[model samples]
Target: MPIIVNLDVLLAKRNIKSKELAKIINITEANLSILKSGKAKAIRFSTLEAICEALSCQPSDILEYVKEKE
Candidate 1:
């Protein structure tokens, strides 16, 4: 996928655990795992907002786009 999920990096930088982030965002650890692994097809805006708030980060901090070489 061109879009890369960088949730793990952000979590590590903030010294926050995935389980704690899940609780703060009111999401299940399983769901957060799916997102962290870049398996989620889509993310709700509300969920994104919650994550940003919990991590004290911007959306760009969690997501990135990389052009694939052709």
Candidate 2:
């Protein structure tokens, strides 16, 4: 996927556990795991907002775009 989810990196940089983040964001650890693994097809804006708020980060910190070589 061109869009990469960098949730794990941000979590690590903030010294936070996935379970803790999940609780802060009011989501399940399983769901957060799916997002961390880049398996989620889509993320709700509310969820994104919550993550950013919980991590004290901008959306760009959790997501990135990489152009694939043709």
TM-score of 2: 0.97
Q: Which residue pairs clash within candidate 1?
A: none
TM-score of each: 0.98, 0.97
Q: Which residues of candidate 2, in runs, are more than 4 Å off?
A: none
**Model 1 spans > 4 angstroms off:** none
Q: What is the overall TM-score of model 1 with all chains considered together?
A: 0.98
In order of listing, the candidates' clash counts read 0, 0
Worst 10 residues of 2 by lDDT: 5-14
Local accuracy of candidate 1 as per-residue lDDT tens digits, 1-70: 9999999999999999999999999999999999999999999999999999998899999999999999
